[model samples]
Target: MSSDEEWSSGEDDSQPSKLVRKAREAPFVPIGLAGCLTLVAYGLYKIKDRGNQKLSVHLIHMRVAAQGFVVGAITIGVLYSMYTDYVNPTSSKPKK
Candidate 1:
């Protein structure tokens, strides 16, 4: 089988994962990923100095940071879409 067929589940335009499609269309996905990685790295660095602290606590914070970044990116994308669609439409329409 070809690489495309292998990556996709079925013989359709829709890919196996929705995240892949969104990452292609949305610009914020890369930024969100970078932010998440930075937060996780920071968490790791902070945890390394404190051997007495529970690892689970630091892990939870990392998870929260990642989720928060994803949520924020989605929110910004939605708002920007709304603005382009309603507030400042770029498409030209004939007046009725």
Candidate 2:
């Protein structure tokens, strides 16, 4: 699959990932991603303007990888919590 196909967004014309299509899909995924990007930008700023300033080709992919990691982590966490709360029902109270 093409790069776009593999990472298509729900808001775009193309289809989104299955992880994003789930009922409990995080609405704030992009917001969390924005936070990652902001951190990356700040890192770039610090590395470029303040430190060694030597840019590397790998740094360009940092945004993509970090955002994916953030979204994936959140998705997994949500699914796990849903499973534990709804499917297993691990409360202290006894069932009537």
Candidate 3:
């Protein structure tokens, strides 16, 4: 037997190649925050006012608070998506 044949750790070359995978989705924060936000909005909606004059004011206040929370959560989701999927510089520096 040849020394060349004896030295080889052989592997077959007949398999088809596969493409690299697309990036994975971010796990849970966006959805969890969304749920909590919904619950808060519902709670706000269910608050009762004794007078009709104050009910409109209460609903409006609740609506504004819910809308603000939604906007803030959406902003956070956008920034997180951008950081995970688009902002790969291969390294990060820790804050002091």
Winner by TM-score:
1
Candidate 2's residue-wise lDDT over 1-96, tens digit each? 766556546565334555566523454566566668776876676664544434664475565766776787678767766776788876623878
How much lDDT does each candidate structure score?
A: 0.77, 0.62, 0.56
Off by over 4 Å in 3: 1-46, 49-53, 89-96
Per-residue lDDT tens digits for candidate 1, residues 41-73, read 888888877577788987997889888997898
Give per-model TM-scores.
0.61, 0.37, 0.43
C-alpha displacement of 38 in model 3, angstroms?
4.1
Residue 94 displacement (Å), model 2: 19
- 1-96 per-residue lDDT for model 3 (tens digits): 876554423343223211111112433345545655785668565775335647677767666766676666667867876775679534333457
lDDT of model 3 at residue 24?
A: 20
Candidate structures ordered by lDDT, highest first:
1, 2, 3
- Give me the runs in candidate 2 sitting further than 4 Å from their true place: 1-25, 49-53, 57-61, 88-96
Q: Give the TM-score of candidate 1.
A: 0.61
Q: What is the model-wide C-alpha lDDT for candidate 2?
A: 0.62
CA deviation > 4 Å runs, candidate 1: 1-24, 91-96
lDDT of 1: 0.77
